[model samples]
Target: MLRRGNEGKKPLKEKIILHYDILFKSHGDDSFDTPTFWEEFFLLKAHPDYIEKKFESFVAKDLIQMKDRLNFLFEKCLEYIQCDQPVRVINALQTMSCLFRGIHSVEVGDHGFDKINLLVGFDMAETSMQVLLRCLTAGLTNDHYNTTIKAVILQLLLVIATGTDNISQNTFVEYLMTNEELYDTLLELLTDPVARSRLGNDTVLLLALMVNYRKYEGVNPFVMRLSVLDDELALSCLGSVISSAFASFNKQFVSKQEESKSSGLFSTITNMVGSMFIGDSDEQKQMIKSNEAILLALYEAIHLNRNFISVLTHSHTDATLVGTPPHTPGGTDDESVPSQPATPTPESFVDASTTRNVLSTFLQYTSVVMQDTKLKRNISSTKLCFIILTCITEDQFANSFIHDENMSFQVCIHKMPMRHRKVKAIVEKPGAPLACWLLDLTVEFIVSHMMKDLPFSQHMRCLGIIHRLMCHEKKCQIRLSYNWRELWTALINLIKFILSNESAIFGRWKKGIFALFTLVINIFNMFITFGDTFLPTPTSYDELYYEIIRLHQVFHSLENFVLRHNANPEYKDVSSRLASSMVNVLAIVRHFNPKIEQYMKDNNMASLTEEEVLEIVKSNYDDLTLKLQHSLDHFERYSERPKETHFFTELVRSISEQYRKTMVFDNIDLQDFMHF
Candidate 1:
């Protein structure tokens, strides 16, 4: 029994030290069967003050002895796990986890540098790897273990798999991948009906990490085995996880009008499942094809939760009554009034009320679902949305689901609210403001998918979604009504973010630049077409001026980047086309706002002569050429064999090819537009 209150406080530190000393002294020879001593030691070690202040020094003084003792304890723990003694097993696992956590903390120098030299000399990685493999093997082969024990084992494995030391992590991955039995066991556990409800999300997450590891380290034999795993089996496994996640989410949050924080579990499962299909390997393609059930599950889950159609059609009856035909024009009021109720006509089917409801519900659902799944707030939601978007855009079968007359995409759009009041309360209410969700979702999609350096075709598919949304007149009008400047700022900042991060635009800078240019042009066109109707007030005019200045700066930044890279023959044509596009846009800007033209002149942009621009371009070209030649000389002198051309060289070649096929000059020809 522990002492209480002030009596315990005075001697607490002394008591902890005494406990530690006795445990070490008793187990000094690396042999101990005293459970009481071990339990006392575990409790003392787990105290926050002891762990934070004294654990490292205690372990450091006799490092060899401590390691050997830990090794013995770990072996004992494994034995305990196999004996079906739940209490002992849990305590043992917890003790081992804590020890490993301490060891990792010390090894990584996370505890500070007072004992780095002593900690570094120990081979903790080798011991950790051995223990990790043994635990994994035991967990796999043991059938008597219940879900609680299995969850503990899985959690321990996660800790070991994500070890701080690279050597141990690599060794663990190698072991897991090389052992076919282990792989099969993990798959079985993931799909097991009883275990999946409790551990499916975590299991899929581990597999995702495994997949990522394999991708990063280059081809592995394990990946081939995974690919060849029966496609139907893989799909069924993934579908089970997704279904369980959705069921859990629905159970918790289905009745609430506002979303609950607990929905993260469902998001996690969907994200993991989606991540499993991110690559374009034939195996992945086949797995995706077989997993249509997952998509259907998500659709049904969303449909049941939101009931978009009912929400959309709720006000339809009221709308139809108000839209009744007016009394005959020339008749007196008494005579004009119909004897019977106004008869329905073909025109009534397309009444203002129906159109309003449809559009409202559509916008509402789109915003709400997007907010729910945005990557910034939830990776699972992001992945789920990506999967849904990809399927709708790329797969015919999934496309048909959305476009089916019975489940019309238009109906989905119509379910959303048209007025800001309805949308403002629900969309992103807990996170960002409602007005920013769409922009946030767009940026999240790009960053999550594109920044991974996936194929250009995949990037194009993502961009296509944004393009479709921006081009829709109704969507644009709705967005403008609900704080358009906020949306506009988000887009501008997104472009700037891409420009600043080389990885985001890697190997596809031309297309990225072209996309930004097109976005700016589109925004300008919106302003030109809608003008004060969208602007609404004087504050909007001020915001518009600021936006124009930002656009001018972005244009200059792109031009400079192009000029700096134009020395290469591959970039010359793209550079020229981009420059031409910039010029065309500038001409339109001058027409759209005379005040902006004067601002440009004050900033010396108006005074930038063609000769000066050429001079800047030529200087950049000379500097880049010199640098390239010097790099080539150094490589030739130092390298024994010829070095293959750099990836950037291939990137440039690809961009050149893409530019020729997709580049459009003077595409935005706003030359004919009269000034607003």
Candidate 2:
């Protein structure tokens, strides 16, 4: 017998086998696992790290003389896994994970894998499967090191169920459906926390692989059932898997090739979102908010699925944010200052009634503008903004949505006081039924969120728009004698409420604002065209008379806010680069007349129709060439021509076009439009 040196009493897993093999030839009737010393020695083999490479020569000697010591080890695993000790049964899963690692890194080819696979399939009972599920589940919450092992086993099973290259895929797929116990075992693993966290997003990655392999089913009910799970972790896993299935699928996999599974992922996600709150209990809700692992998983799911993302992000009617902050705008009251409101602004020329009515009209018109889907908005931004804006203005506009009180279709008619002292009302009709209701709900949500605890940038962007509209000449109506200083003062004070206190918008919110602002700027151009015009081009301006008051109010508001921020040590330079440039445009807007009103009046041009007058104005209007150039020169001294860049960009783009123009008209779908 070859005597390998015994260092720290190595397990006779090899030695006992070697002794048995030698006896099988030279001697006879030898078995192992003696009560104390040998059992203790075998226990040491449980931890392979203790057996150093210094003993490698001994390991080779033992294997050469012994009969497959590793195969003998796995036989012990099968025997003890279902025995008296359930706690030690978990060790089998760890050993299995390690075994797979050994097979991948240690085994060379099909021969090694076949040996490994044969070991894995060693006739396990239903109890064994359940125990493995429980072990995987428990391991998820176990210490970090244990989680690494459990994850490997789960990945192996997932791949075994789906992958093309794996021999286990065909058998596992059939077993998943017909083999009820097997399917339940897989389900139990999914509900396990440690396994899920380990898998993270790879479950989706695997599903993508499944679809690509043409081994996928159409509208799987098991996936559907899992999606409806009340547990956030399970739901999140389901959602990620669903989104991945959708994304993983491409034009390559069609009905002709793989029996078109078109709505499987979409239906799964939609149903999940619709029922996210249904039957979800207190424990589960708390579990969702506090669990960082689960929250990240849920966010990933929400991020990937378009329909699910829409419901979560938009704050619409049916789906609302659960733990939203309270709404407080730091706003002054409307004339009647409650104990809470510090001091209200002093009145200018326009009364509160007229101002409110004007705002109401603006809201209604804005609702119409928002709900106009004829502009071909094929994506999320178009839908989200239009939906949100409509919902916000729903209370203000009667036509766009059915009022809760009457549930009747009614036009929101605002009385405009004509020069002759006669009042004429302007009415905008409602859009389609579904669109109007959805939009109205979204509007209400936005207004509610706007008033609530939100980031300051939200207030700054939204309120800035509102303040600009309020101070429009048609609404503000400040007389020529009225000091521009007081108008500036009124506008400035309001901005203080908006950017008052908060974290700045520097990331996604900033980018989203830029996108929204793009729409707003286009809308502003439309609004400007609809206003007083002496244009050669329809989009051109009346200039000197209309006050261009929206831009003026915004300018004043920004300047006041910036100066205030700079004054406060905490807030200095925090107004953002976006705020400063707004002031520059406001400063120079005074120079643009398009065609000087006095010069045109001296030439008896007041009688000319606006369209005819537009031609002369277009030829004469050198807003970019002369006035903006002059403003840019002055701007360089103070703010380094911040506004000039945007001003010139617009000025050059607009002025070069042909002067022949019509008013920026309200285009509506008469087929869908319901008038009151």
Task: Provide the RMSD of all predictions against the true structure, rounded to 1 decimal.
Answer: 22.8, 25.4
Instruction: Report the alpha-carbon TM-score of model 1 versus the true structure.
Output: 0.44
**Tens digit of per-residue lDDT, candidate 1, span 332-426:** 23222233336866543333433322222323333333332222222233333443443332332322222223432222111122221122222
Model 2: per-residue lDDT, tens digit, 613-675?
445445654543321111110101111134333422232222111110111112212222111
How many collisions per candidate?
14, 14
Once superposed on the true structure, which residue ranges of model 2 sit more than 4 Å away at CA?
A: 1-45, 48-72, 90-93, 110-118, 121-222, 230-296, 299-676
**Runs of candidate 1 exceeding 4 Å displacement:** 1-65, 108-143, 165-173, 231-234, 243-462, 466-513, 518-676
- Candidate 1 — what's its lDDT? 0.41
| Among all candidates shown, the one with the greatest lDDT | 1
The local distance difference test score of model 2 is 0.32
Once model 1 is optimally superposed onto the true structure by TM-score, how far is the C-alpha of residue 445 displaced, in angstroms? Answer: 9.6
Best by TM-score: 1
